[model samples]
Every structure is written in C-alpha cells, then in structure tokens.
Target: MTHTFEPEANKPGTQAGPIPEAAQETLPVVYQDEHLVVINKPTGLLVHRSPIDRHETRFAVQLLRDQLGQHVYPVHRLDKPTSGLLVFALNGDVARALSEKFNDKTIKKQYLALCRGYMPSQRLDYALSVKLDRIADKHKQQDKAAQPAITDFTTLATCELPYAVDRYPVSRYSLVLCEPHTGRKHQIRRHLKHAGHPIIGDAKHGKSVHNRFFANTFQADHLLLSAVGLDFSHPVTGTRLTLNCAAAPKFIQAIKRIDWQEPDWAVAIAPKWLAHG
Candidate 1:
C-alpha cells in the first residue's frame, strides 16, 4: 500500500468523484476493532494514488484517514472500479499480520459479477499474462511467463434481452459468482474476458458494444464486479471471521433490470457486522 503524507503539497480528498463530499461519511464500515477497519468501498475510488492514474484524486486511504482522524494501513487492494468489502489495519504490525494471510492464500474471497453472453457453472483454470500499468511497472518489471490463474464460477441467473447485440438477435447475460484461487491484477476481469463472458460495464478487458449498451440502457457506467464476501482467521485472536458486504446501488439496479432473482450469495442490505466498522 502507498500513501503520501504530503497533505500540504496536495489535497487528494478535496478533488472528488461523482460521490459528493457530503456522502463521504456515508461510506459503510463493515468490520472494525482496535486492530482492523474494513469498509464497503464505493466504485471509482482508488485504493490509493497510483502513477497509472495520475489525475485521480479521490482515494480510499485518504477518505478513511480523514474520516477516522488517524492513520490506517491498507492490508489488501480492490481495483478502483470494483466496489465492496475492503480491509485496513490500524497500525503497521496489524497490517503485516493481515498481509501475510493474503500472501498465503488463506483468505477466501467471493465476488459477484454481471457478464455478457451465457456462462455455465465451471472452474476457469487459465493462464494470464502480466497486465502492467504504463506508468507504474513500465520499464522496471521483467517480461515473465504467463501466470497461472483459476476462478471457480457458478451461473446464478441468465437474461436474454430483446434487442440485437452484435450478431445475435437477442443479447445474453449471466449473473456469475467468482472465487479466484490466485490473486493477480485484474484477475477476475481478465479471466472472465478470456472465457468469452467479459463483465458488463467494464471499459477494460470487455466488449465496447456491450459496455455502451449498459451505459445507454441501464445507466451503469461502472464495472459490474463486486467483492461480496471475505473470510479469514483473525491474526490476534485466531478466531474465524466471515465478513460480507452488499453490492453497489448501480449493480443492484442493473441486475434488477434483467429481472434477476437475488441468489443466496447476494448479501443483504445490512450485514450484522456493518455497524462495528
């Protein structure tokens, strides 16, 4: 995780996304204690500033720090366009402890996504090339072999739109549950694209025609990918913890437009642990 303490030199929070400055307090907290703070991050907000997106000024770390009036350490990252549960540590020690869990693959994560075309319940065990940011990893990174990536997916619902999309008379979509076995940058989005069912509203690794259709019809300009649930054992107490976050409003809106029934995996309006964070 990267953070700049140069508050006087630059004001990150002052620059804004579509989310109003007043709505910053409304950011949902999913889990919290002396050691950890987990939040339901909104779409288009960066996990932290990156050289890849120099113009982006709104970030989760900055918002949370200002909201809590203290320093919070990022334990893991959720892509800027992806929303849902994100965890942060209260201090460096806790951050290291939690980061170890993520590195070891002991942390289990589940994501909900809306995709184009039909996808059956199957495990996608595919290899993906390294996706580098033009600014961040441009010349410093080595050209390595494709990494192994696996995502277990189950189709929860399907929709066939009346309008002709591309070649087909009717557009097909699916509500997919994704559990990625490996953590790579854009793993889920790229894997879904490779499987021929790229996520809806994904400007990257997705079909532009389908993306424009969602923007025109459903008013969804953000990617339809959400981290719905996370499970891990606490580093201090060693107790098993299960944290779930509800999907973004636009995601729910898009699913509803397709008449998708809420599957068991979809989280509720409020999970029990929300108030604590």
Candidate 2:
C-alpha cells in the first residue's frame, strides 16, 4: 500500500457557503473551500453512476459539478438510499489525500437509523461478502470469501408504535447510532441485518413488511438512514473539522412517535454543529 498524501493549496477570492434549507431541493453545500466542497446529499441520489443502476442520469458527481460550475472529484461513496455529508475535492491531489484518509479508517462517521426491532446497545462484529456488480465484476469470484466488517451501535431510544407492522400487533422500533469501523459496500445496512435488526426503509437488506409500513404510514420511500456527523482532519489545513447534518423530516417524525425527547436528544447528545445551527 502507498502512503503519499499532499493536498493542493487553496486559491484566494473564491467563496463557499453551507447548505441552506431553501437549497435542499438541490444539492446542499454543507461545507466548502477552494480545495474541498462538502454537500448534504439527499436520499435517492447516487454518488456516481454504477452498473447497479445504469439508467441514472442525475448523480451527485454530475449535479454538484454543474451546481458549482467546476469539476469535482468524489472522495468516497454513500449508498443511493443513504443521505448525509458527502465530500468532493475541487482538484485531484486533494481528492487523493482525502481518499487515503478514508482507506486508513481515519475518517470518523456517525449514522442515525431506525431499526425494525427493539435492540439494546451493542457492538456488531461481523464480516460481509463483497457485493459484486453485474457489469464491473462479472468475472470476479462469485463465491469469494467474506471481508472483515464491524460496526458499533448504541440505542438512543426505543418505542412501540400502535401499528401492526409485523407478526405482533404493535410494531417495535429503536433509534440507533451506528458507527462503522470499515467502509465495505452496504456495511452498516448489511451488518444490521445480520444482527437481526435491519434498518427501516432498507428495501434490499431490510424486512419488506416494515418497509411497506413506513412507506404507507409515513410516506418514507427511501432508506431511513442519515450520516449525521463526520470528523476528520482537513486535507489542506490539517485542522480537525467536525460536521453534522440532521436526518430527513420523515425520520424525525418517526422518532417523535417513539416519544424520545427530541430537543433533549439534540442538546445533550448531538454534536456542536447541529447545536450551532
């Protein structure tokens, strides 16, 4: 493995701003500088095109590049159904530096999710098979061994909704904070499923009954997963930067149904980024 990291210097006279609520309809800039630009990617938007979905024309890479009037290099990828902070480098050198950080597991990320069943706080230790693509990895080993994957989960709250979502009359759920130790494709979602508490609205690895329940009841057509916070050293400045973004409105509505103290949850446990807003 190579370990070369050097970020490009920023040019003066260019200004970047955070994503405002009004701009949520489009790609919202969470943080931006001359070297790097971060966006709050909405659910259902691909980070880039993949053989998994060949028909997608509007992707984060294309949308952000056009939105900013410049080319952007994607440092990492978030699943199309996942929403949260996405980082893009204005240039290639910076992109390489940031990508190295992600590979080395130096970039800290926290995700918020609603799960199907009541789960206590626990560390999920498991491995996942690499999800191969139809076109890209067609020749790769179809029966390749599983790769190491781990995730830490803490239950922030739990509740029983008055709806028959499963075999039971009342549906059970938990709001969990998921921190993945690896960046394997669909790591968090897959790990949670292996632990028998799949994320709500995860159509592929989740329970279809609960997914339909959320869709019909809450109008939640996408995964109820959000990258709520990220902490990493800036590629250019080397400053430790912490950023956080709230989940989609429908997620909050589901949380409210659990009777979790939303305001207390924010003030006591949320990062300063959300508090500052």
Query: Candidate 2 residues 108-168, lDDT tens each?
Result: 8989898878877898878888899878789888987989888999887676778877778
Q: All models: lDDT?
A: 0.79, 0.78
Q: How far is candidate 1 from the true structure (C-alpha RMSD, Å)?
A: 7.2
Q: What lDDT score goes with residue 179 in model 2?
A: 93
Any runs in candidate 2 off by more than 4 Å, and if so which?
Answer: 1-25, 139-143, 261-277
Global CA lDDT computed for model 2: 0.78
Highest lDDT: which candidate? 1
**Pairs of residues clashing in candidate 1:** none
